[model samples]
Target: MLDALIQQSVCLTQHYTGSPVCNPSRAALLTGRYSHRTGSLDTLEWWGLERLALREEWLLPLGGLAVPGDLDHEAAKEDKEREARSDVHEPSRPSRFVSFAPLRDFVFQPAALDHYAATALFLACVRRLRPDFAPTADDARHIARICRLLEGMPLGIELAAPWAGKLPLGEIADELAAGLGLLATTLRDVPPRHRSMRAAFDRSWALLSVPERDILRQLSVFRGGFTREAAEAVAGATMADLSNLTDRSRLRVEPSGRYAVHELIRQYCGERLGAEHEAEAGETAEQVHDRHAAHYAGFLRVLEPQINWRASINSEVGPETGNLDAAWRWVIEQGRYELVQAMVMGLYHIAVAEGRYQTTLRLFDAAVQRLRAQRGRGEGGAGDAPTDLLLALLLFCQGHMCIDLGLLRRAEACTEESLAVLDGIAPGRLREEQTLYTKGLVALLRSWQGEFAEALRLRGELLSWLRTTEVSVWPHVPQVGTLFVQANECASLGFLTWHLGQYDVAQGWLRESLAIREQLGEERWRAYGLRTLAGVLRTIGELEDAERLTRKGLALSEAHQDRIGIGWSHSALAATLMSAGRPGEAQSHFVESLAVAQDSGHHALLILSLNGLGALALRRGNLDEAGQLYEESRASFERLGIAGTLRYAEAVIGLGEVALARGDWSRARARFREALAARACRAWEKMDAVAGMAQVFAGEGDTSQAAELLALVAHHPFTAHATRERVEALLAELEAELPAEVFAVATARGRARELDEAVECLAA
Candidate 1:
């Protein structure tokens, strides 16, 4: 069965030496004889080997024998004839024979002992023989070179051992570099093939068929290792071809099912290919690289969506990141801009989502530079809608990333350029569709920068366009990602209103968008909607509903690994918990939210989280802690160009409360005044500021002034039960401190003050 298996294998090279010496082992194997029967128990008695007794149990060797000059065929023939005459039946063996070379495996590294024993023993013999030599450190380095050249093969080490004794290890290493020609042993006992390393490799090379040789040479192009699919694409090799190479040990299939060639063998194969295609002048090598680049470029696209949708960022795509990088390098170097664009687009989403800011920034910058260069050369943008759209999309993505980082100026610049590119393209519904979404982004950025009036105007325009325009006119392709801009349009409007403190109205818009996203099966956007609506709910005294919505959003964010959504949901959840009087739970969520926001570089989200934490601290009467948190959050909002926004209004209120706790009544009034001055603040937020100033007035024993501010707060809906209770306590206190006629007059005077006059009252 073993003989049959050997016959079926494509190629097999056997060097079985049952007697430990070449001549004796050859005599035994060729004549099917045991060492005792052959009278070759030792190497010294192997001369003129003939007449060996056959072992009945021994199987025939069925592969070709290529003994290059060591064990001569003439000697084997004499042994066969002697065996026939000695009444020993000739063992059945394959008749095919060829001249070939065998490349030896390297086992020189210290770790190699785990896999190879013969090479280890050879090294042991060398060390023992040279005990008195006492080579220098540099000489030890040269010894490593010598080992590499001989690939630590048992025969090669044995042959090179004599030179190591006669010359310095460095000189022996240099001589080997001139190939086996100069390293040949002059001893008459050693065969010519066994004298040098090259002879063995040459003998192995001679046995390969043309197709097998071609496959081996092509496989040298791969770096690291390659999958079978990659091998088939880049090397133009089939499974059967790889299997044959693997069986012959020309290619090694790793346990992971990847194929790899030994480094030395790869170098040898590269040289072989270079020699064969000298006339082609490296053209074939270039083609292989191109195929490799193309193959991995496609691979990036397949894994792109999963990057933001799952936590497989480190598992599935992480390992292939090197290959994708290689592909990008080649594409960029070769000026394959279209491929570069595709690769960049595929990787950018995951890169940004994974918080690989530096990588994504570099890739985006490179892509834009390349695209501009191509356009300069008149190689692109000549009615290339797809490429133009892709370019615009990349700019838009960069703008969004900038927004996350709170770089509103840069965000505006990117979105403006994206919009310009879209406008520069041919006029069409698709262009208009993209223009509306890009406009919404610009508006959102404006809103982030505290330009509420301008932002609301621009967003309102986009909302109008989306409402009047039919969804059928928009591009139906999956590349649109969100498909309908209406959902996002509504969500953006909701967010803007949320900043304006119209919590009740914001909740409706966000809910509408959430329902639309659910119908569209856009889970990522749905998470956004849930988080936004939760913030609105939290502000409007709906703690339980806020917690539920925020938890749902947090679950979705975690499931999708959307760090931005996760951060937002965490802050919103923290706000709900803080309002529910769960300070400890709220503190942890606030910390987690801040950490996530900071790591993700979402400055806008960070502002909200910090403010939430500050509010919680204020509620717990940790005046110093709340003051620090609120001031830091205020600085962030201003740094992001979003000062005076409703978010900032809340932070101002916390700072006022901090002042009130410190008995700095005048400073408390000033902070409250700052929030009341922002006319865009929601009625409830303005009421909170007014109520705070009332507390300051009451602290100063001015019951009449306190009654006026308290009356203004009484007219609006109370968002926080704690704030409402505080206001009621102050109102009752004012009523008890003053005469009924005085309290009634002050309350009526506060009620008579116009909303703007009331806000200006604090401002004045």
Candidate 2:
């Protein structure tokens, strides 16, 4: 019966009951002969009963039999030889071999379950563990989080699901966040290694060689994924070790060719790195961290020129943001001021473009504090221009960040301190350039404070000096010569002139700045110039051109992932849409700008977005919503101590329009008067206020006064096309109401009034 079964390719093997050991029985089953005849022995001695004779293979046909039995090392070697012989003779039936181990178990496969599948698996396990439990929406979310934290490992999910009976899902998630020990089961029916996440991880951990373990420990220092080069440099991982570890599923290779360890596994390795014995070379965790920091510092140094001069819009710093931030904190902790100084400017530009104002402010503030403490200790060398220069630059950069955050008072103090630090430095080309840069930041601060005239004067003087003076190239870097400063000054002049309602002059200055920026390949500055010029064009009623330029800027900003630039571009585009009478589209962009502003803590942009939303609401005839949004904008500007800004005036004018719609004549006049009195209210915005005042006068039956204000606004050269059209419509209405001769006289008198006279009439 056994021979017929073997001949039919259904061979079975088992330990013989009479034998004291299983090896002899296993050898007989493999060779279909007596153990002694096959050179297999039952004696427990060196090389006994472990191997079958290499020449014997009579149990079953190699290609057609399913032989189910354990094959030790020597027995497996003999089987392979016999199988090869059989393959050569048969010429058609090829033998195959497949091996399985706990390390390559199905539960540990590389492919993770998707979200829905993971959730269903978790819930199913939970139901099996506690049949009466029902999951809530919050429970589902927490389960999803737990699955993500565990990398969707099946045994991990099964081990964690039992805890749902003892703790809330959120608490279970919190416990998992604290450590991986929460993923353990007390169920005795399960296998020992399968019952706990740690045991399973230990099975894999024990398989790694000493060098592989050391490399993994070092790799724990990385926060996000790392490139092969970074892994080799920081962790001392050779290609063979990385490949071996990856094959064992110890590290995962991302689609982008970066490598990452599971977060739970990373935590485990990090703990071992912190507490384990020193490696063969006596390298400590601190030493590994130092290497990590040094590598990234050098990395940033290599990319610094590109970040500063060429690649501000789309720099290589994005992928390494996590690593760079970690490296920055480490250097700051170690008081490695020189390394910090080397990477500060590049990091500053990155923070500005990405709208990480608050985070970068804290980092730079810490750096400044550390430097000040070092100075107090007298640790700095004598005539330390580099140290002082770093301090000055940090202060100037911090001031710019503060301006973005609407902390104008702090910005002013920072600028003052930066200038004072520059004064202490010995007069040289470096000091001269730094001083000029700091003054430009101060001018920007003044403009934000609604002191446009002062900003304009400072920028004009800077531009003249930069253009006329012969700025020799620095010994180290010659790329950032006087031309860069001249371009910055010209951009500043354009911004100030725009705020002052000189649209044509603003356009000319912005175009010149853009030409220089293009020549220098400053894509970021070019995008900014395009957006500003678009605003000018929009105000002049060139809607098609304005939209085109605005979209181009938007595309550039989106491509660079520049959050601030994107928000500003959206706001600019929305304003153009509002002028073009597309309220629905305008509202959507305004909402997008508001969201970005809120997320980035950009206070100025937030206020601007609110004012824009208010305009859209007023256009849609939602008077109450418009009033509320305008009031919020006005209050925010007041709280920020920038109530004199043109934005605040615009908000006030919006409220006046709301009142005019409601026929609240007294409230309308009051709002218009407040707007006209704002110091930053330039010619076009003042004309808007005058138009509101004229409507109020007409509502109160003062026809002659209303006609005069409307005519005055229509005749102003700086009046925007949109405002002028509205004023003309109001004047025509007044002409229809009044007698012909009386209307003609009122119009002539109003057209003769100067801008200042018109503003005074509105204020009265």
Top-scoring candidate (lDDT): 2
Per-residue C-alpha lDDT of model 1 across residues 563-677, encoded as one tens digit per residue = 5566677777887888888989998888777765665566767777788888777777788888999999888877767677546787888898899989999899899988877
Per-residue lDDT value at 717 in model 1: 54
Please give the CA lDDT of all the candidate structures.
Answer: 0.62, 0.70
**lDDT tens digits, residues 369-442, model 2?**
98778777877743468888888889999999988888888999999989987887888877777787799898
RMSD of each: 17.6, 15.7
Model 1 segments beyond 4 Å from truth?
1-289, 300-333, 340-345, 373-388, 467-475, 478-483, 638-642, 676-684, 717-722
**TM-score of each candidate?**
0.62, 0.76
Clashes of 1: 7
